[model samples]
Target: MLLMPENKDQLVSVLTYHVVSGKVNAADVVKLESADTVQGEQLMIKTTDGDVMVNNAKVVMTDVEASNGVIHVIDTVLLPE
Candidate 1:
């Protein structure tokens, strides 16, 4: 993911939401309420019945990890507005 400096806060939050309580699958994300990222930002996660949301985006893919951290593909790019 490419996060610009201005979007650092949102980036951190988004990154955190991607992390699993355990080694997660895409389905596990729906159960998260929040997460703290490596960059020291908190991400708000939301799930309603059969729906799940992260900030203002949806997780289209998940559990893609790297040596540095994990990646969850979101349908929309998040920015600090």
Candidate 2:
């Protein structure tokens, strides 16, 4: 979806849904069922046959460290409903 800031709240919500507060690595991610985002929503996490999925996106890369947190690259853009 094209997230234009037509509604500032909605745009921020959508963006925040992509982020979780703490630094969650791939190892830690597979252990959890869901994670709470900064947007005040829970993101569903699933692992099947050694494949990790966050929401509807497949995790492509993991353990990318940043100044504040780690980054996990996913195949698709996730949209919250």
The most accurate candidate by TM-score is: 2
* Clash totals, every prediction: 0, 0
lDDT of each: 0.64, 0.89
Per-residue C-alpha lDDT of model 2 across residues 1-81, encoded as one tens digit per residue: 346556777778778989999888888999999999998889899999999999899999999999989999999987778
* Model 1: worst 10 consecutive residues (lDDT sum): 15-24
Ten-residue stretch with the least lDDT total in model 2? 1-10
Residues 23-73 of candidate 1 have per-residue lDDT tens digits of 555566676787654445556789777656777878776668767555677
Candidate 2 C-alpha error for residue 4, in Å: 4.6
Clashing pairs in model 1, backbone N/Cα/C closer than 3 A: none
Candidate 1 — which residues are off by over 4 angstroms?
Answer: 1-24, 65-70
